[model samples]
Target: MTDHAQEQEMEIEALEAILMDDFKEIDPSESGVSTTNRCFQITLSPQEDDLDASNYTPVQLALIFSHTEKYPDEPPLLNVKSIRGIKTDDLNMLQEKLEGEAYESLGMSMIYTLATSAKEWLHEKYGQNVLDEVVEEPASTKDDIIIPHGEPVTTETFLAWRERFEAELALERAKLMPESALTAPKDKRLTGRQWFESGRAAAKGPTTVPEDSEEEEEIDFDDDFEDDDDEMLEHYLAQKSEKSAEESKN
Candidate 1:
């Protein structure tokens, strides 16, 4: 294969790794697909205290990636295949923002950038404060107004929303507590400190030492001892006792 072809393959691999690592909302299968004709769906949900939590529902978007035969030399195409629970205006805004990103990031890895831009747009447009104040009036057409236009609230939706809200609340509470108090495990898994220390050590570099070598280092301590100071102390004490006895007799 040519150098350009090799570079394109590397770019695709980089994109795949990024999606797998950073975009946890994308499924494993979806992230593993070939980048030649990449298409996948991703879901974005707001944090519990997001301004529009009252009308918040998860937004799903289908992403399509197109790359030229000379990929890294040319910018990839990112188009939204489908979007649910987002208004047409918001969808258009997201597309515009993505197009701007693609143009700005020409000759660079743009797939991850495009996906992150879309996520930001979703949060800005859908995760805003829509129910800030009570407006008094219009009792007749109150039912006609939809806070979030597309999706209706059902049992399943409510349960999903409640679960997300509670999880976010727990996370916030955890943040407020002292680090020592946040030691309880939510599941049978590594503790937070263990995870952090492992990650830190990994970042620092390799830290493997042979068991026998470590034991040898631990046992190599000095064993010699001296008692000159003790002898000196005893002589000083005997002299002091003689002086005190002579003083008492006088």
Candidate 2:
């Protein structure tokens, strides 16, 4: 109905598109504040690249806000909550920082901007090795220690590791190939290891039918029958030749 309302509507749509599952419209009562306007919350986490650097405790937080009746003219009411592995003091500090930014960002759609700031802060504060200090130690490492790598290989995982090793060696040799050969390769090549990933691999050895297979038995039976028929024909021809010779002699 008003310019402020129109701006809020557009910003909400943009945030929903960008944040996907992380952004959601929450009940007004969830804000714990008496308000006639819409309230919403955004889940925030540290950026992904930094999280991959080392073992770290997962951290998350929520940025909850409500538009005032005259949003954009007045700053939105903001709050921060520790969703995971965040301390109370951290939430207070973030709340004050976001509220200050809200005032500074008055007369504009500030929720998305505030969410971005919160995410960046989360990354800087908790990303990489910084989270090691806050990560919880296992109750017992001797028994309860989780595997750091992936699922362990089973007996059924008869991988052709030798082929993969040879392939890798070949790849290394290929790297040392002539400059002209490298420039225009004959075919697209993928390593055996690459092919063997994710349970989708070719059989390691040549495919073989079982020794007790009925197909092989059936083939052997047909061959034996053909051999017997040939022997009978040879015997019959021999007898006919002998009889013709005796008749000619008489």
Candidate 3:
């Protein structure tokens, strides 16, 4: 194969490795085939070629590989687009801050974070309260916005936090379920108004016999045979004596 073709092949392999690594943290199977394709598209971008503190975030750098032509050594043309969320002013500030840095080669996510510490600067300069408020109503534009819309933030950085947030929400739902279930009336497995409705239904239900009904069915005992008992005993004694005499003779 030509050197250019060989270079493209290597870039593809590297990009695939990054995506596979992501699969470790997230279930690609659950996400769908499109997710892998999307990841590939990002990984093959020209922005990846210029990955550095000056050029892109870790996510942006990872995406560059997939954007390159199959023959990479012919000089890949970058149609690099930033992800949404970063504001336009923020992008200017980021570029100014990253002036001296140049991406020699790509590295892991942490390297990107370290290289682009612009977020940290923004927080420190603007204060936590202001930054938090601005982040909520993220700027929506394509004017090469730096922080929010310039490029999508790496999922490695944000997805983990999002998953934890989701888990906490699920836990909160679970916590409420038992309380509702326990307070629920026998006729229904819900609570509050439903419980009240269930209680009404139970009140209208069929009347069952009392658990002690067997005891109520029992009859009282009496000694009515006592008067004839003595006479019977005397007769039995006389018969017993006659039988004894006959046995003695035999």
Candidate 4:
């Protein structure tokens, strides 16, 4: 193979490995780099906390990368496709920013750089504060619907809120229950006694306490021990009183 062809193959392999490691999925039809041509598409998802708790719809975007024959020496063409929840102007701005980034990375592997830039742009444009941009009007008919904090109240919003609340509540309840209780049939709710019984039955391991240790023996609160304790307490009190008296006098 020619030196340029080998270089192209090596670069393609490195790019493929980067994509596989970074993204959960990539379509081969949309991603490839060869001696003659190079093109790839990557889908970027918004962060988990990007949407308002009530907003069920998530924002996603497909970034298509097109490279010239002189790629790695020249910048790649970046196009935004399948965009959701962002304005056209915003997307244009993102494209401009990415183009600038590619130009800045003149002679380096630019695929990972482009992908990282796209993700950061998505977070900035459509993350947790997305609702602030959506509900621009001062008032609307949808205002009457009560929603959870950081979420707009709609049918989907209410459902998402309920799901989140239930998940958090279940976690709290699990904290109070024994580990053995978690193994019980989820559909069957066990009473307090039943929970105790299940836990007791599951605990078949040897006892942690020593069989006949002196520490476990009953203590004798006899007069001699009590007298000694009282004397020590009196001595401590006397010393404390003397310290206080000296400080007050000073």
Candidate 5:
């Protein structure tokens, strides 16, 4: 595949994976598309087995935003069709962003926004039920059950932990990020150097140990006779000093 095609495929696949595993609550399949709990609904048209937004009706196009470019910050672009009644302000904003030579060259990001806007526009023009499909999950059975308490953490638990960690890391990252960078448009995200600096600052923060705390750590000496001998010598010297003082008094 060409670079454009490859990038599109990767984006689609990545979106599918995120929707299926993370957004299972959305039930993308209810709209006649095949999907797991992850919101990415796979569809087949004529000879093809997957969705191609270029082929979808204006309404069907809007639903694509549900899973594929689900985030408000990172939207997908659809090139095939345009919404009929987009607000003037929205249009102007989009035009301004598109006019940038930089955005024009970043075809993937541009396409993403197009696809995402198309999805939302479809829902607005059509109705919600237009995108709803029957969502069916497999019936649960005891066969897959290893008792939770007795078992090591399940895949779900590990995934949950990872998600929590990611969220915490994100909060820490945000804390370290320049306020200007944080408020900038999504496309104008922090550069690699900024990210590295923020990450280093984040990594260094909560993990720091205070000097007093370090000093308070009990010294762990070796369990050898040398320590015992040192203690004995100190006691002997103290006693000898006392006896010598008595002799001096005599």
Candidate 6:
């Protein structure tokens, strides 16, 4: 057989494997078509587990199609028919949709795709019959509909979230600084180089900066110098003491 026929056979086998009793091979002549083409029928409906038999208007459809000589390269002919309670209008609409899909799916196996689309459509349209049931359904029916959950946190996501959260948190904390958390007055010492760089040593006398004064700030790889801050403080104090001793000696 040609690739087209071989592909059709494989698709038929896959459908049978999946649908079991719900799929069947039909004689092309039965649908008033020539025997040269192959035909198939698949029954479709909302999942039985989702239906409320008591209040449900049962619906089932038969999606019938035949592979053409150039099928997959060209679209196949299809017919949708009511097998149970499905209406003529519904069948027509579904067939229209399948035809559109078949056009889009040219050069690929698509009967199974169409069948799946039909089943989902059927469920959307007819599956809601369960809502009409007078009795409350068991939780199992509710469980049938998966509640989509959040995506798992990946390393990339975690890092992105942490960056955003820390920025927001810092902004909020900056807006409120408790007085109890303020450094004690005695503990207000600058890094020694920072004091000299600030030009505070040029001041001749006591300059009391108002605690309430708004000081506009003008905004370093001195890493090794961090360990020498205490030594720098002692050096400055010793020079002041020596100057005082020389004055005393004079």
List runs of model 3 lying over 4 Å from the truth: 21-40, 43-74, 88-250
Estimate the TM-score of every prediction.
Answer: 0.37, 0.48, 0.22, 0.41, 0.19, 0.48
For residues 38-86, write the lDDT of model 1, one tens digit per residue: 3344444433334343254455555556566666556665555344566
> For model 4, how does the per-residue alpha-carbon lDDT over 1-250 read when each residue is reduced to its tens digit?
2354455557667767766533333443554323234556676756654443334446777787766667677876667764466777877888788889888998766777787778887877677665444555566564586646765557787898899997876565455555556777877766443443344334445336676776663435353245543343444456568889999999
For residues 1-250, could you state the per-residue lDDT of candidate 2 as single tens digits?
4688788889899999998888898888787657857888898877564454224436878898888879988988787888777888878888888889989988888888999899888888776545555657667655343567977554344366666776777665454333554565447443323322211213234447898887742334345335543343444456568889999999
TM-score of 1: 0.37
Winner by lDDT between candidate 4 and candidate 1? 4
**How does each model score on lDDT?**
0.55, 0.70, 0.40, 0.62, 0.44, 0.71
Report the C-alpha lDDT of model 6 over 118-159, residue by residue, as the tens digit.
Answer: 988888877677345336755665325343797755668889
Candidate 5's C-alpha runs over 4 A off are 1-9, 19-59, 62-111, 128-250
Candidate 1 global CA lDDT score? 0.55
Best by lDDT: 6
List the candidate 1 regions with Cα displacement exceeding 4 Å: 1-4, 21-57, 129-250
Candidate 4 weakest lDDT stretch, 10 residues = 27-36
Q: Please give the range of 10 consecutive residues that has the lowest summed lDDT in model 2.
A: 195-204
Query: How far in Å is the alpha carbon of 205 misplaced in model 3?
Result: 86
Higher-TM-score candidate of 1 and 6: 6
Number of backbone collisions per candidate: 1, 0, 21, 0, 22, 0
Query: RMSDs, each prediction?
Result: 32.2, 24.6, 29.0, 27.1, 31.0, 16.4
